[model samples]
Target: MEEQSVVLVVDDVKTNVLIMRQCLKEMFQVWTADSGEECLRVAKQKPDIILLDVLMPGMDGYQVCRQLKADPETAEIPIIFVTAKDSDDDEQKGLEIGAVDYITKPIRPAIVRARVSTHIQLKQHSDKLKFMALHDQLTGLYNRHFLAERAAQSLSAMVRHQQELSIVMLDLDHFKKINDFNGHHIGDLVLQAVAKLLQDCFRKEDVVARMGGEEFVILMECGLDIAREKTEDVRQQLARLNPMGLEVTGSFGVVTANPQNAELSHLLVLADEAVYKAKADGRNCVVCYQDGAYLTVEHD
Candidate 1:
């Protein structure tokens, strides 16, 4: 069963809070905050939707909504204004401030539930579309787009901190043979299995991504030595996998860019050159690129 969506109800009035809780409790996991200050704190939890009252003691709902919308983390959250301040100007102001819907007080339970349900559904759909845009449909790995997005950010931080960063690029050996021999469906399963192994072998901080068919990249905050060692280990593990009883191996290229030239695009190019060298030397081997020289670290 799917998890229940969370709804945060923010209001200063105890009775109104109780009423909203009663109306929503059965349909959602309802969380309540009695003041705008507490609502801001609770908003960090990222509830699916927020029901905010426009008037409160210290900070008003408008201030809360403005703050939430200002923050990138919480900005996408849907906010619905539920209050007694019922007027054309009040509703217009609330809508202008980013509330998805405005409901006047002396509230009808049924109408509030229906509106909340509709907006929550819309929020879910929007969230899914965003996820699909950033992820690969196959293998469920980060696609080239996400990899490029994170690469620039991480590269910037690496240069700023004077820290080490390395790129490990992998390409399956003779991948077309797998699709030709085992069929695309079995080949897909092999790719997924390898992706899972990559995920398990790398740390949470590492960015592992699929850069189109049969090619993958790993970004890690380590020197060439550590990157090559880790890539070698994954290479051995992948060789042993034999996913679906089909033997498979991948060629790996490891490279650490110079601090003065810490650019992802340039680093990737060197990594690709190293991978090509690995394929030339022999398949299922690890190669490191340093000072424009490719060194074979491991071979099988």
Candidate 2:
């Protein structure tokens, strides 16, 4: 899961807080705060949505909202100002201060549930769409465009964290022959099957993407040994996949980030070169890219 959506209820009144808790508990993980100060404290926990009371003892909902918007960690969390102060000015002020929606009290349970559910769903779908936009539709893997984006992000994160990053490029063996002999329908099935196998073999956090025309790439947070093992695992698993009686095998090229200079393009080029080298050496093998050269693994 990307991020869990929690609903934070902020109100000084205990009964009103109880009512909201009863209403929203089944649908969301609910957190409660009695005052604006408490709300800020809870906000640090990073709830997905906030149901804040407009009139508090010291800091009002508007001020709470202002503080929330000001903080980078809590800024993305949607806030809904819940209060009895129902005026055009009140609503406008809430909106102006970055409340995504406003709801008036004497609260309706149905409306609260509906609004919360709707907003959470919207956010989830929006995130998914953003994800899909950068990923391949056919293989449900990251597309080439996202490959570059993710690779860049990964490289930066690696630099900041001083962590090892590995890139692997894979190309389907004799994919054109499969298409010609088995027809495009079976070819598609083979591609899908291989994609599923790749997904199954890799960790959930690993970024796997279809790089168009029977080529795919994986970005893993790992050292050289782990990268080599995982790439070999994928290659072996794919080799065993005889889809619809059609022979299916793949070539893998892996490159690990070096301490000296680990640019995203350098990793990509290294992986790509290793993949082609695997093909040239005779398919169904794994190649490791290290210090500007390819190391090929021979099959027994």
Candidate 3:
């Protein structure tokens, strides 16, 4: 099924909102905000496109556009100013504040629809390109480059708030045997399946990434106890995945993020150590880093 793109229409006038809704409803899911404050709040829903009206009471469209552009979360959402001011100067100001296009008042349905459709298509293309750059093509998991960036940002916030953070480094045990006995095509399918299951095992806030061949990592917001339990859960799930009668199991190494030593590289090193320990203890197990030691956790 094709995903429905959302269009946020912000106007003080109810008639304007109704008109735009009527014009665009066939092509997009329409949402409305009658004032600037409501527009800012609704924008957090991450609409695919926004049709904003200038001259709203207190906060104008230009001001609202500036705020949206300033926020990293909402900065990329396409905005178009639809207002009564037709002067070139007014249009220039709208574009200057990050409005993608400007449409004067006395709305023409065809023109509004055409402009909105063009901008929405452009935004969709931009998002697809960004996803290709940040994600792994084979497994649809995040690539290592994006992983480092996200890990750094997440760690910074965790440290500032003194919240617990954990990293789980996982490797498919005896994965080479499967690739050698079967073929790369079968191996690829196994990797994809593992990636999907790992993603399902964690919360949305957690970061799951394909580090490289047969390796994955999860950055989650929890301490040792919860991390260990989750790691074991993943291990048991992988063991149950017998693709083509081939036994599948993964070794996991987990480490909590220490605020004083919270660098991504440092965390990876600790997690790696724990994973190696799991391997030494005869694969298909979980090891956790605690109090400067990597200790194997007995399965629950």
What is the lDDT of every predicted structure here?
Answer: 0.91, 0.88, 0.91
Error of 3 at 121 (Å): 1.1
Clashing residue pairs for model 3: none
Quote model 2's TM-score. 0.77
Give the runs in model 2 whose Cα sits over 4 Å from its true position: 1-12, 17-50, 56-77, 87-93, 108-121, 259-261
Q: State each model's C-alpha RMSD to the native.
A: 1.9, 4.3, 2.1
Model 2 lDDT on a 0 to 1 scale: 0.88
lDDT of 1 by residue, 1-300 (tens): 788999999988999999999999999999999998899899999999999999898999999999999999899999999988999999999999999999999989999999999999999999889888887888888888998888888888887887788999999999899999889999999999999999999999999999989999998989988898899999999999999999999999999966766778888889999999999988799999887789998454
lDDT of candidate model 1 versus the reference: 0.91
Q: After the best TM-score superposition of candidate 1, give how far the Cα of residue 46 lies from its true spot, in angstroms.
A: 2.1
Q: List model 3 lDDT by residue over 1-300, tens digit each.
A: 797889999999998899999999998899999999998899998999989999999899989999999989899999999999999999998998899999998999999989998999999899899998999999999999999998888889887898888999999999998899899999999999999899888888889999999999998889989989998998999999886677889999999987778898998998998889999999999999999988888875
Identify the superior model by TM-score, candidate 2 or candidate 3: 3
Q: Write the per-residue lDDT of candidate 2 for residues 1-300, one digit (tens) a residue.
A: 544469999999999999999998877889999999999999998887899999999999999999999999888788898999999999999999899899998999999999988887887788789878997887787788887887788888888899899988999989999999879998888888888888899998898889899998899999878999888877888888897787888888998986565687777778888988999999899999876778986566
After aligning candidate 3 to the native by TM-score, how far in Å is the CA of 33 from where it should be? 2.9
| Backbone clash count for every predicted candidate, in the order shown | 0, 1, 0
TM-score of each: 0.92, 0.77, 0.91
**How much is the lDDT of residue 83 in candidate 2?**
93
- Candidate 2, residue 277: Cα displacement in angstroms equals 1.1
lDDT measured at residue 248 in model 3 versus the true structure, 0 to 100: 89
Model 3 RMSD in angstroms: 2.1
